[model samples]
Target: MRCDRIEDLLPAYADSALDPRERAEVEVHLASCPACTSLLACLRAADEALAVFPEVDPGTELRGRLVSIAAPRQKFSLFTLLRKPSLQPVLTAASVLGVVASLYLLNPGRRDFEKNVVRTFHRGVGRVEKLYAQAGGITGSIGSFAENLYASLRSSNPLERDKD
Candidate 1:
Protein backbone atom coordinates (compact mmCIF):
# COMPACT_ATOMS: atom_id res chain seq x y z
CA MET A 1 0.00 0.00 0.00
CA ARG A 2 1.10 3.63 -0.62
CA CYS A 3 2.25 5.73 2.40
CA ASP A 4 -0.73 8.13 2.09
CA ARG A 5 -3.26 5.26 1.90
CA ILE A 6 -1.56 3.61 4.89
CA GLU A 7 -1.68 6.96 6.78
CA ASP A 8 -5.45 7.29 6.08
CA LEU A 9 -6.11 3.74 7.19
CA LEU A 10 -4.01 4.21 10.39
CA PRO A 11 -6.87 5.95 12.31
CA ALA A 12 -9.34 3.19 11.38
CA TYR A 13 -6.62 0.58 12.13
CA ALA A 14 -6.14 2.07 15.61
CA ASP A 15 -9.93 1.95 16.07
CA SER A 16 -9.92 -1.75 14.94
CA ALA A 17 -12.58 -0.90 12.30
CA LEU A 18 -10.59 -2.44 9.37
CA ASP A 19 -10.87 -6.04 8.10
CA PRO A 20 -8.00 -8.46 8.94
CA ARG A 21 -6.53 -8.33 5.35
CA GLU A 22 -6.52 -4.46 5.23
CA ARG A 23 -5.12 -4.27 8.78
CA ALA A 24 -2.29 -6.66 7.84
CA GLU A 25 -1.45 -4.48 4.76
CA VAL A 26 -1.38 -1.28 6.88
CA GLU A 27 0.76 -3.02 9.55
CA VAL A 28 3.31 -4.02 6.87
CA HIS A 29 3.46 -0.42 5.57
CA LEU A 30 3.69 1.01 9.10
CA ALA A 31 6.62 -1.37 9.88
CA SER A 32 8.50 -0.05 6.77
CA CYS A 33 7.54 3.69 7.17
CA PRO A 34 8.84 5.61 10.24
CA ALA A 35 6.65 8.72 9.48
CA CYS A 36 3.44 6.63 9.40
CA THR A 37 4.51 4.76 12.58
CA SER A 38 5.03 8.13 14.35
CA LEU A 39 1.58 9.32 13.12
CA LEU A 40 -0.05 6.13 14.44
CA ALA A 41 1.73 6.66 17.80
CA CYS A 42 0.38 10.28 18.02
CA LEU A 43 -3.16 9.04 17.11
CA ARG A 44 -2.99 6.39 19.85
CA ALA A 45 -1.73 8.93 22.42
CA ALA A 46 -4.61 11.36 21.55
CA ASP A 47 -7.11 8.50 21.73
CA GLU A 48 -5.75 7.47 25.17
CA ALA A 49 -5.90 11.13 26.41
CA LEU A 50 -9.52 11.41 25.25
CA ALA A 51 -10.43 8.10 26.88
CA VAL A 52 -9.05 9.29 30.26
CA PHE A 53 -11.72 12.03 30.49
CA PRO A 54 -14.63 10.73 32.60
CA GLU A 55 -18.12 10.92 31.04
CA VAL A 56 -20.44 13.19 33.00
CA ASP A 57 -24.25 12.80 32.79
CA PRO A 58 -26.14 16.07 32.99
CA GLY A 59 -28.89 16.38 35.67
CA THR A 60 -32.50 15.74 34.53
CA GLU A 61 -33.35 19.47 34.68
CA LEU A 62 -30.26 20.43 32.65
CA ARG A 63 -30.95 17.68 30.09
CA GLY A 64 -34.56 18.91 29.75
CA ARG A 65 -33.41 22.53 29.26
CA LEU A 66 -30.83 21.46 26.66
CA VAL A 67 -33.43 19.45 24.75
CA SER A 68 -35.87 22.37 24.82
CA ILE A 69 -33.21 24.78 23.53
CA ALA A 70 -32.12 22.41 20.75
CA ALA A 71 -35.64 21.50 19.55
CA PRO A 72 -37.16 23.60 16.73
CA ARG A 73 -40.47 25.31 17.57
CA GLN A 74 -43.25 24.89 14.98
CA LYS A 75 -45.15 27.98 13.85
CA PHE A 76 -47.71 28.86 11.17
CA SER A 77 -46.16 30.87 8.31
CA LEU A 78 -46.23 31.25 4.51
CA PHE A 79 -42.41 30.83 4.47
CA THR A 80 -42.92 27.32 5.88
CA LEU A 81 -44.45 26.39 2.49
CA LEU A 82 -40.89 25.62 1.34
CA ARG A 83 -40.16 23.32 4.32
CA LYS A 84 -42.37 20.53 2.92
CA PRO A 85 -40.23 18.06 0.88
CA SER A 86 -43.05 17.05 -1.51
CA LEU A 87 -44.13 20.61 -2.36
CA GLN A 88 -40.64 21.80 -3.38
CA PRO A 89 -41.18 21.12 -7.11
CA VAL A 90 -44.70 22.62 -7.01
CA LEU A 91 -43.45 25.80 -5.29
CA THR A 92 -40.52 26.12 -7.69
CA ALA A 93 -42.81 25.74 -10.74
CA ALA A 94 -45.29 28.28 -9.35
CA SER A 95 -42.47 30.80 -8.69
CA VAL A 96 -41.05 30.42 -12.21
CA LEU A 97 -44.51 30.69 -13.86
CA GLY A 98 -45.38 33.78 -11.80
CA VAL A 99 -42.13 35.56 -12.77
CA VAL A 100 -42.57 34.65 -16.46
CA ALA A 101 -46.24 35.77 -16.51
CA SER A 102 -45.38 39.05 -14.78
CA LEU A 103 -42.50 39.72 -17.18
CA TYR A 104 -44.69 39.04 -20.26
CA LEU A 105 -47.52 41.29 -18.98
CA LEU A 106 -45.22 44.10 -17.76
CA ASN A 107 -42.76 44.28 -20.68
CA PRO A 108 -42.80 47.82 -22.16
CA GLY A 109 -41.66 46.71 -25.65
CA ARG A 110 -44.39 44.05 -26.09
CA ARG A 111 -46.72 44.89 -29.02
CA ASP A 112 -49.01 41.83 -28.97
CA PHE A 113 -51.65 43.67 -26.87
CA GLU A 114 -51.56 46.58 -29.32
CA LYS A 115 -52.08 44.13 -32.20
CA ASN A 116 -55.09 42.63 -30.39
CA VAL A 117 -56.58 46.13 -29.86
CA VAL A 118 -56.09 46.96 -33.56
CA ARG A 119 -57.71 43.64 -34.56
CA THR A 120 -60.71 44.40 -32.31
CA PHE A 121 -61.06 47.90 -33.86
CA HIS A 122 -61.00 46.44 -37.38
CA ARG A 123 -63.64 43.83 -36.45
CA GLY A 124 -65.87 46.61 -35.04
CA VAL A 125 -65.52 48.55 -38.30
CA GLY A 126 -66.46 45.45 -40.32
CA ARG A 127 -69.56 44.88 -38.18
CA VAL A 128 -70.61 48.54 -38.67
CA GLU A 129 -70.13 48.15 -42.44
CA LYS A 130 -72.46 45.11 -42.44
CA LEU A 131 -75.05 47.09 -40.43
CA TYR A 132 -74.84 50.01 -42.84
CA ALA A 133 -75.22 47.70 -45.87
CA GLN A 134 -78.24 45.93 -44.30
CA ALA A 135 -79.96 49.30 -43.58
CA GLY A 136 -79.36 50.37 -47.20
CA GLY A 137 -80.35 53.97 -48.15
CA ILE A 138 -83.17 53.95 -45.55
CA THR A 139 -80.66 54.44 -42.68
CA GLY A 140 -78.17 56.73 -44.46
CA SER A 141 -78.40 59.33 -41.66
CA ILE A 142 -77.99 56.65 -38.96
CA GLY A 143 -75.09 55.08 -40.92
CA SER A 144 -73.30 58.44 -41.10
CA PHE A 145 -73.94 58.94 -37.37
CA ALA A 146 -72.60 55.45 -36.61
CA GLU A 147 -69.57 56.11 -38.80
CA ASN A 148 -68.87 59.35 -36.91
CA LEU A 149 -69.19 57.54 -33.54
CA TYR A 150 -66.75 54.84 -34.66
CA ALA A 151 -64.21 57.46 -35.86
CA SER A 152 -64.51 59.36 -32.55
CA LEU A 153 -63.99 56.16 -30.48
CA ARG A 154 -60.90 55.20 -32.55
CA SER A 155 -59.40 58.67 -32.26
CA SER A 156 -59.98 58.86 -28.48
CA ASN A 157 -58.30 55.49 -27.79
CA PRO A 158 -55.13 56.00 -25.65
CA LEU A 159 -53.11 53.44 -27.67
CA GLU A 160 -53.97 55.22 -31.00
CA ARG A 161 -53.13 58.60 -29.43
CA ASP A 162 -49.80 57.24 -28.17
CA LYS A 163 -48.92 56.13 -31.71
CA ASP A 164 -49.38 59.71 -32.97
Candidate 2:
Protein backbone atom coordinates (compact mmCIF):
# COMPACT_ATOMS: atom_id res chain seq x y z
CA MET A 1 0.00 0.00 0.00
CA ARG A 2 1.07 3.67 -0.60
CA CYS A 3 2.06 6.06 2.23
CA ASP A 4 -1.06 8.25 1.73
CA ARG A 5 -3.45 5.22 2.00
CA ILE A 6 -1.59 3.96 5.06
CA GLU A 7 -1.82 7.47 6.56
CA ASP A 8 -5.64 7.41 6.15
CA LEU A 9 -5.84 3.99 7.86
CA LEU A 10 -3.61 5.11 10.80
CA PRO A 11 -6.48 6.87 12.66
CA ALA A 12 -8.74 3.75 12.37
CA TYR A 13 -5.81 1.52 13.39
CA ALA A 14 -5.22 3.70 16.47
CA ASP A 15 -8.95 3.39 17.39
CA SER A 16 -8.89 -0.47 16.76
CA ALA A 17 -11.77 0.03 14.25
CA LEU A 18 -10.13 -1.72 11.21
CA ASP A 19 -10.96 -5.40 10.32
CA PRO A 20 -8.27 -8.11 10.56
CA ARG A 21 -7.40 -8.03 6.83
CA GLU A 22 -7.12 -4.21 6.84
CA ARG A 23 -5.20 -4.25 10.13
CA ALA A 24 -2.72 -6.74 8.66
CA GLU A 25 -2.24 -4.59 5.56
CA VAL A 26 -1.80 -1.46 7.69
CA GLU A 27 0.65 -3.28 10.01
CA VAL A 28 2.70 -4.50 7.03
CA HIS A 29 2.84 -0.93 5.64
CA LEU A 30 3.69 0.56 9.06
CA ALA A 31 6.65 -1.87 9.46
CA SER A 32 8.18 -0.49 6.22
CA CYS A 33 7.18 3.26 6.41
CA PRO A 34 8.81 5.51 9.07
CA ALA A 35 6.53 8.49 8.18
CA CYS A 36 3.35 6.45 8.80
CA THR A 37 4.58 5.08 12.16
CA SER A 38 5.32 8.69 13.25
CA LEU A 39 1.81 9.77 12.06
CA LEU A 40 0.19 6.93 14.05
CA ALA A 41 2.16 8.07 17.16
CA CYS A 42 0.90 11.65 16.65
CA LEU A 43 -2.73 10.43 16.25
CA ARG A 44 -2.46 8.43 19.51
CA ALA A 45 -1.01 11.46 21.32
CA ALA A 46 -3.94 13.62 20.09
CA ASP A 47 -6.49 11.02 21.23
CA GLU A 48 -4.92 10.85 24.71
CA ALA A 49 -4.94 14.72 24.96
CA LEU A 50 -8.68 14.91 23.93
CA ALA A 51 -9.68 12.24 26.52
CA VAL A 52 -9.01 14.62 29.44
CA PHE A 53 -11.89 16.95 28.49
CA PRO A 54 -15.36 16.05 29.88
CA GLU A 55 -18.23 15.53 27.36
CA VAL A 56 -21.07 18.09 27.58
CA ASP A 57 -24.75 17.49 26.69
CA PRO A 58 -26.35 19.80 24.12
CA GLY A 59 -29.27 22.11 25.20
CA THR A 60 -32.83 21.05 24.28
CA GLU A 61 -33.24 23.88 21.73
CA LEU A 62 -29.93 23.02 20.03
CA ARG A 63 -30.77 19.29 20.00
CA GLY A 64 -34.19 20.03 18.53
CA ARG A 65 -32.67 22.25 15.85
CA LEU A 66 -30.13 19.51 14.95
CA VAL A 67 -32.88 16.90 14.76
CA SER A 68 -35.03 19.16 12.56
CA ILE A 69 -32.09 19.74 10.16
CA ALA A 70 -31.28 16.02 9.93
CA ALA A 71 -34.89 14.90 9.45
CA PRO A 72 -36.23 14.80 5.85
CA ARG A 73 -38.55 17.61 4.66
CA GLN A 74 -41.93 16.52 3.21
CA LYS A 75 -44.25 18.76 1.10
CA PHE A 76 -47.83 17.69 0.34
CA SER A 77 -49.22 18.25 -3.20
CA LEU A 78 -51.37 16.56 -5.89
CA PHE A 79 -48.32 16.38 -8.19
CA THR A 80 -46.47 14.40 -5.51
CA LEU A 81 -49.22 11.77 -5.47
CA LEU A 82 -49.20 11.62 -9.29
CA ARG A 83 -45.40 11.23 -9.39
CA LYS A 84 -45.30 8.00 -7.34
CA PRO A 85 -43.96 4.96 -9.30
CA SER A 86 -46.49 2.54 -7.76
CA LEU A 87 -49.49 4.72 -8.75
CA GLN A 88 -48.36 5.21 -12.40
CA PRO A 89 -49.93 2.01 -13.81
CA VAL A 90 -53.18 2.53 -11.85
CA LEU A 91 -53.54 6.18 -13.00
CA THR A 92 -52.70 5.27 -16.61
CA ALA A 93 -55.25 2.40 -16.64
CA ALA A 94 -57.95 4.65 -15.10
CA SER A 95 -57.41 7.43 -17.69
CA VAL A 96 -57.36 4.90 -20.58
CA LEU A 97 -60.62 3.32 -19.30
CA GLY A 98 -62.20 6.78 -18.94
CA VAL A 99 -61.41 7.65 -22.57
CA VAL A 100 -62.65 4.27 -23.84
CA ALA A 101 -65.88 4.45 -21.80
CA SER A 102 -66.54 8.01 -23.01
CA LEU A 103 -65.88 7.13 -26.65
CA TYR A 104 -67.66 3.71 -26.77
CA LEU A 105 -70.35 4.09 -24.07
CA LEU A 106 -69.47 0.64 -22.69
CA ASN A 107 -72.26 -0.68 -20.43
CA PRO A 108 -71.74 -4.32 -19.57
CA GLY A 109 -74.45 -4.46 -16.80
CA ARG A 110 -77.36 -3.57 -19.06
CA ARG A 111 -78.50 -6.59 -21.08
CA ASP A 112 -79.83 -4.55 -24.09
CA PHE A 113 -76.86 -2.16 -24.27
CA GLU A 114 -75.03 -4.26 -26.89
CA LYS A 115 -78.13 -4.50 -29.05
CA ASN A 116 -78.69 -0.76 -28.76
CA VAL A 117 -75.11 -0.08 -29.82
CA VAL A 118 -75.49 -2.37 -32.81
CA ARG A 119 -78.71 -0.63 -33.82
CA THR A 120 -77.13 2.83 -33.51
CA PHE A 121 -74.10 1.68 -35.52
CA HIS A 122 -76.36 0.28 -38.26
CA ARG A 123 -78.33 3.55 -38.39
CA GLY A 124 -75.10 5.59 -38.74
CA VAL A 125 -73.85 3.29 -41.54
CA GLY A 126 -77.22 3.51 -43.28
CA ARG A 127 -77.11 7.33 -43.16
CA VAL A 128 -73.58 7.26 -44.65
CA GLU A 129 -74.78 4.93 -47.47
CA LYS A 130 -77.75 7.23 -48.20
CA LEU A 131 -75.46 10.29 -48.36
CA TYR A 132 -73.13 8.46 -50.76
CA ALA A 133 -76.11 7.55 -53.04
CA GLN A 134 -77.30 11.16 -53.05
CA ALA A 135 -73.77 12.35 -53.89
CA GLY A 136 -73.55 9.85 -56.77
CA GLY A 137 -76.92 11.01 -58.15
CA ILE A 138 -75.91 14.68 -57.95
CA THR A 139 -72.61 13.87 -59.71
CA GLY A 140 -74.51 12.12 -62.53
CA SER A 141 -76.88 15.09 -62.93
CA ILE A 142 -73.96 17.51 -63.10
CA GLY A 143 -72.27 15.37 -65.76
CA SER A 144 -75.44 15.33 -67.92
CA PHE A 145 -75.88 19.09 -67.49
CA ALA A 146 -72.31 19.72 -68.64
CA GLU A 147 -72.80 17.42 -71.69
CA ASN A 148 -76.03 19.22 -72.60
CA LEU A 149 -74.34 22.63 -72.28
CA TYR A 150 -71.51 21.47 -74.61
CA ALA A 151 -74.11 20.19 -77.19
CA SER A 152 -76.05 23.46 -77.11
CA LEU A 153 -72.85 25.50 -77.61
CA ARG A 154 -71.75 23.31 -80.50
CA SER A 155 -75.17 23.63 -82.29
CA SER A 156 -75.12 27.46 -82.08
CA ASN A 157 -71.41 27.88 -83.04
CA PRO A 158 -70.67 28.92 -86.71
CA LEU A 159 -67.01 27.86 -86.25
CA GLU A 160 -68.14 24.35 -85.30
CA ARG A 161 -70.51 24.22 -88.36
CA ASP A 162 -67.70 25.31 -90.70
CA LYS A 163 -65.54 22.56 -89.32
CA ASP A 164 -68.25 19.99 -90.09
Candidate 3:
Protein backbone atom coordinates (compact mmCIF):
# COMPACT_ATOMS: atom_id res chain seq x y z
CA MET A 1 0.00 0.00 0.00
CA ARG A 2 0.99 3.67 -0.45
CA CYS A 3 2.62 5.64 2.41
CA ASP A 4 -0.40 8.03 2.54
CA ARG A 5 -2.87 5.15 3.12
CA ILE A 6 -0.60 3.59 5.72
CA GLU A 7 -0.12 7.00 7.45
CA ASP A 8 -3.88 7.18 8.26
CA LEU A 9 -3.83 3.68 9.83
CA LEU A 10 -0.72 4.53 11.94
CA PRO A 11 -2.75 6.20 14.72
CA ALA A 12 -5.23 3.27 14.86
CA TYR A 13 -2.34 0.79 14.84
CA ALA A 14 -0.69 2.66 17.72
CA ASP A 15 -3.92 2.31 19.78
CA SER A 16 -4.36 -1.38 18.74
CA ALA A 17 -7.79 -0.44 17.33
CA LEU A 18 -7.39 -1.97 13.82
CA ASP A 19 -8.68 -5.49 12.92
CA PRO A 20 -6.06 -8.25 12.65
CA ARG A 21 -6.03 -8.24 8.82
CA GLU A 22 -5.82 -4.43 8.69
CA ARG A 23 -3.13 -4.49 11.37
CA ALA A 24 -1.09 -6.94 9.28
CA GLU A 25 -1.41 -4.76 6.16
CA VAL A 26 -0.38 -1.64 8.13
CA GLU A 27 2.58 -3.56 9.60
CA VAL A 28 3.74 -4.59 6.12
CA HIS A 29 3.55 -0.96 4.90
CA LEU A 30 5.23 0.37 8.06
CA ALA A 31 8.14 -2.07 7.55
CA SER A 32 8.93 -0.53 4.13
CA CYS A 33 8.19 3.14 5.03
CA PRO A 34 10.54 4.89 7.49
CA ALA A 35 8.24 7.99 7.58
CA CYS A 36 5.23 5.93 8.76
CA THR A 37 7.41 4.18 11.37
CA SER A 38 8.64 7.54 12.69
CA LEU A 39 5.05 8.86 12.78
CA LEU A 40 3.92 5.81 14.81
CA ALA A 41 6.83 6.39 17.24
CA CYS A 42 5.79 10.05 17.62
CA LEU A 43 2.11 9.06 18.27
CA ARG A 44 3.23 6.54 20.93
CA ALA A 45 5.44 9.16 22.61
CA ALA A 46 2.49 11.62 22.69
CA ASP A 47 0.21 8.90 24.14
CA GLU A 48 2.76 8.18 26.91
CA ALA A 49 3.05 11.90 27.73
CA LEU A 50 -0.80 12.24 27.88
CA ALA A 51 -1.14 9.12 30.08
CA VAL A 52 0.50 11.02 32.97
CA PHE A 53 -2.70 13.05 33.44
CA PRO A 54 -5.15 10.86 35.42
CA GLU A 55 -8.81 10.88 34.25
CA VAL A 56 -11.27 12.38 36.75
CA ASP A 57 -15.06 12.04 36.83
CA PRO A 58 -17.04 15.25 36.77
CA GLY A 59 -19.07 16.30 39.84
CA THR A 60 -22.67 15.01 40.11
CA GLU A 61 -24.22 18.46 39.56
CA LEU A 62 -22.03 19.14 36.51
CA ARG A 63 -22.86 15.73 35.08
CA GLY A 64 -26.58 16.35 35.66
CA ARG A 65 -26.40 19.78 33.95
CA LEU A 66 -24.50 18.25 31.01
CA VAL A 67 -27.05 15.45 30.64
CA SER A 68 -29.92 17.95 30.80
CA ILE A 69 -28.28 20.07 28.10
CA ALA A 70 -27.70 17.07 25.82
CA ALA A 71 -31.09 15.45 26.42
CA PRO A 72 -33.85 15.78 23.72
CA ARG A 73 -36.58 18.36 24.27
CA GLN A 74 -40.14 17.38 25.26
CA LYS A 75 -42.23 15.83 22.44
CA PHE A 76 -44.37 18.05 20.23
CA SER A 77 -47.86 19.05 21.49
CA LEU A 78 -50.66 21.19 19.97
CA PHE A 79 -51.32 22.77 23.41
CA THR A 80 -47.66 23.88 23.51
CA LEU A 81 -48.06 25.45 20.05
CA LEU A 82 -51.28 27.25 21.02
CA ARG A 83 -49.65 28.64 24.18
CA LYS A 84 -47.01 30.65 22.27
CA PRO A 85 -47.36 34.42 22.81
CA SER A 86 -45.91 35.27 19.40
CA LEU A 87 -48.44 33.06 17.60
CA GLN A 88 -51.48 34.39 19.50
CA PRO A 89 -52.25 37.23 17.08
CA VAL A 90 -51.69 35.03 14.03
CA LEU A 91 -53.99 32.34 15.39
CA THR A 92 -56.67 34.91 16.29
CA ALA A 93 -56.52 36.47 12.81
CA ALA A 94 -56.73 33.03 11.15
CA SER A 95 -59.68 32.12 13.38
CA VAL A 96 -61.54 35.32 12.50
CA LEU A 97 -60.83 34.88 8.78
CA GLY A 98 -62.05 31.29 8.94
CA VAL A 99 -65.29 32.33 10.67
CA VAL A 100 -65.90 35.11 8.11
CA ALA A 101 -65.26 32.79 5.16
CA SER A 102 -67.49 30.07 6.59
CA LEU A 103 -70.29 32.55 7.23
CA TYR A 104 -70.01 34.01 3.72
CA LEU A 105 -69.90 30.59 2.05
CA LEU A 106 -72.69 29.10 4.14
CA ASN A 107 -75.19 32.00 3.77
CA PRO A 108 -77.98 30.97 1.36
CA GLY A 109 -79.42 34.53 1.17
CA ARG A 110 -76.09 35.85 -0.29
CA ARG A 111 -76.38 33.75 -3.49
CA ASP A 112 -77.02 36.85 -5.62
CA PHE A 113 -74.26 38.70 -3.77
CA GLU A 114 -71.85 35.87 -4.60
CA LYS A 115 -72.77 36.18 -8.32
CA ASN A 116 -72.12 39.93 -8.15
CA VAL A 117 -68.72 39.28 -6.50
CA VAL A 118 -67.83 36.83 -9.28
CA ARG A 119 -68.86 39.31 -11.96
CA THR A 120 -66.82 42.07 -10.33
CA PHE A 121 -63.78 39.75 -10.17
CA HIS A 122 -64.15 38.93 -13.90
CA ARG A 123 -64.43 42.65 -14.75
CA GLY A 124 -61.31 43.45 -12.71
CA VAL A 125 -59.41 40.65 -14.44
CA GLY A 126 -60.45 41.93 -17.88
CA ARG A 127 -59.25 45.45 -17.01
CA VAL A 128 -55.94 44.09 -15.76
CA GLU A 129 -55.46 42.08 -18.98
CA LYS A 130 -56.15 45.19 -21.13
CA LEU A 131 -53.62 47.22 -19.10
CA TYR A 132 -51.04 44.43 -19.46
CA ALA A 133 -51.57 44.35 -23.24
CA GLN A 134 -51.09 48.14 -23.42
CA ALA A 135 -47.94 47.88 -21.32
CA GLY A 136 -46.52 45.24 -23.69
CA GLY A 137 -47.19 47.50 -26.69
CA ILE A 138 -45.47 50.41 -24.90
CA THR A 139 -42.46 48.20 -24.10
CA GLY A 140 -42.21 47.07 -27.77
CA SER A 141 -42.25 50.73 -28.92
CA ILE A 142 -39.50 51.64 -26.41
CA GLY A 143 -37.37 48.68 -27.59
CA SER A 144 -37.86 49.69 -31.25
CA PHE A 145 -36.90 53.30 -30.43
CA ALA A 146 -33.71 52.14 -28.70
CA GLU A 147 -32.77 49.90 -31.66
CA ASN A 148 -33.34 52.73 -34.15
CA LEU A 149 -31.28 55.16 -32.04
CA TYR A 150 -28.36 52.64 -31.85
CA ALA A 151 -28.52 51.96 -35.66
CA SER A 152 -28.54 55.70 -36.46
CA LEU A 153 -25.55 56.30 -34.14
CA ARG A 154 -23.59 53.43 -35.79
CA SER A 155 -24.47 54.47 -39.40
CA SER A 156 -23.35 58.10 -38.95
CA ASN A 157 -19.58 58.30 -39.76
CA PRO A 158 -18.11 61.24 -37.76
CA LEU A 159 -15.42 62.05 -40.39
CA GLU A 160 -17.89 62.11 -43.34
CA ARG A 161 -20.52 64.01 -41.35
CA ASP A 162 -17.88 66.57 -40.29
CA LYS A 163 -16.64 66.99 -43.89
CA ASP A 164 -20.20 67.55 -45.15
Best by lDDT: 3
Model 2 residue 65 lDDT?
95
Tell me, by TM-score, which candidate is best. Answer: 2
Flag regions of model 2 displaced more than 4 Å.
1-109
With candidate 2 superimposed using the best TM-score fit, by how many Å does residue 68's alpha carbon deviate from the native? 23
Residues 1-164 of candidate 1 have per-residue lDDT tens digits of 88888888988999899999999999888888999999999999999999898888888999999999999888788777668899999989999999999998898867987788899999999999998887787688788999999989989999988887
Q: Which residue pairs overlap in candidate 1's backbone?
A: none
> Whole-model lDDT for model 2 versus the true structure?
0.90
lDDT of each: 0.90, 0.90, 0.91
- Models 1 onward score TM values of 0.33, 0.39, 0.34
lDDT of 3 by residue, 22-103 (tens): 9999988888888888998998999899989788988999999999999999989999989999999999999999999999
Mark the regions of model 3 whose C-alpha exceeds 4 Å error after superposition: 1-102, 105-108, 159-164
List candidate 1 stretches off by more than 4 Å: 54-164
lDDT of 2 by residue, 19-100 (tens): 9999999999989888888888989898998888787888899999999999988879899989999999999999999998
